[model samples]
Target: MSHHAKDLLTLAKAVIDTEIAALAALPSRLDDDFLHACETILACQGRVIVTGMGKSGHIGNKIAATLASTGTPAFFLHPGEASHGDLGMIVNGDVIIALSNSGTSEEILAILPVIRRLNVRIIAMTGNPQSSLAQAADFHINTGVDKEACPLGLAPTSSTTATLVMGDALAVALLEARGFTANDFARSHPGGRLGKRLLVHVRDIMHTGTEIPQVPPDASLQQAILEMTRKKLGMTAITTPNGTLLGIFTDGDLRRSFEKGQSLHEQPISALMTVSFRSINAHNLAVEALNLMQEYAITVLPVIQDGSVIGIIHMHDLLRAGIA
Candidate 1:
């Protein structure tokens, strides 16, 4: 191998080894102090204000986002900006989460006095338990690692990963405590596929009234073909005289009939229609429809209400609505 490739491989191994050691060291560090931090943050009525510098700051931003999305109200405040006017963002009822690898970040320490005066609780995450930030905070979490993944031992690598994972641990713990559900997450992320999966009901996308293609079981195959064409769902439901669904005729049926040398206009649809079919309720989630579509390999599903076909939900409809 080339010298450059060998060097890259060594660096990668160093990073992995550093992170493994860091995670292994975490169990001993999990103590009563961590529980106290969780309790303090949970007691706060306002937001959890997160502040960190450099790589710690990047991790803190993600931590804040996870906290906010998982039911805890939180936002990131860059320590550098906090030294300026951003300190004003912290208010009463808020709790501050300060991140510093050495626990002596001047940018973080610069706002310590103001945060204290605001009567907000402080939870410090640091590698040094004896540093100024940890000493000044109400609760301190020890995220110290044996060494940095950086060969010079100056860059933040394992420390940052540990901090980020610790932040996720806090957020998820709070999420469970608050009874945050998938529906709640959907409300927070309405623009994403998860939101679509949770919020969409079968009734919203089902083809209703005359748009549903249905023909009596005794109807000629030509009549069923016309219904399928008019509905454009590539299928037609075969129903009883009282509109109760009996079976369905699809494009697959047409193909099989053509292969058998049978005239499409001659036979009754009931002779070719599938009598056994799986169906979904109108109130079921659209995600359930997606699962059914995948399992059956059928593009169109009949939505049933009170044993009667109320509407038709097509894969194309789900795809258009971003639910598929």
Candidate 2:
């Protein structure tokens, strides 16, 4: 390789190595102080206000987002903006998380007096535990690493990565403690794929009403095949005299019957159908339907309610909706 290429590879490797080492060194830092920070945030009735400067600000913004999404109500405030008049956003019941690798971000420190006056408890994340911000904090978290990924050792790299991970750790710990469910996560992420996975129900995607592929149990095999073909669900439900689902017959069963020399026109679907096939509830989650299909080694499941066939769901439907 040319010298330029080799130099680029070396720099990339150095950056990754610095970050990996910094993360590996974080386990020992999870001490009583981390628990104290979580406890403080949990006790706060208002939102979490995170602020920092430069790259720390960027990491703090992401941290705030993660916290908000995982069940904690949080928002990011620029320290400079707070000093300029945005400090009104912070409430007395709120908790403040301030990030400064050196523990002396001028912008963040400038607003400390005002935040203290508001009486919002502050948690400091810094490299220097003895710095002014750290000393003044209600609880201090050490996000310090031995060095930066920058070759000149001046840019924020490993320190930022460590801070972000620590923030996630805190958010996830609080998430578990609060019994935050997937439904709660979906409410916060209604526009994202995660929301779709959690919010969309089986009835939302299942073929209902006339779209349901169903036939009476005593119906001829030919009639069941016609229902399957019309619905395009690759399967037809066998219903009892009272409209309760008795069994289901799919293309696989049709093929097996043909191989057994059973005449399609004369055979009864109830005799040919899989009598003990798995069924799903229309009110269940779409994700649950996906799991049922996978576990039974089948591509289709009949959705039933009160023993009556209400709809049918196929693996293709789940995939097309991005659930699988």
Model 2 pairs whose backbones collide: none
Q: How do all models score by TM-score?
A: 0.94, 0.90
lDDT of each: 0.90, 0.91
Task: Give residue 278's error in model 1 in angstroms.
Answer: 1.1
Give the per-residue lDDT digits (tens) of candidate 1, residues 100-195.
Answer: 999999999988988889999999999999999999999899999989888888889999989988898889888888889999999999889999
Worst 10 residues of 1 by lDDT: 262-271
* Candidate whose TM-score is highest: 1
Per-residue lDDT of 157 in model 2: 95
Local error of candidate 2 at 237, Å? 1.5
| Candidate 2 similarity to native, TM-score | 0.90
* Each prediction's RMSD to truth: 1.8, 2.2
Q: Which residues of candidate 2, in runs, are more than 4 Å off?
A: none
Candidate 1 collision pairs: none
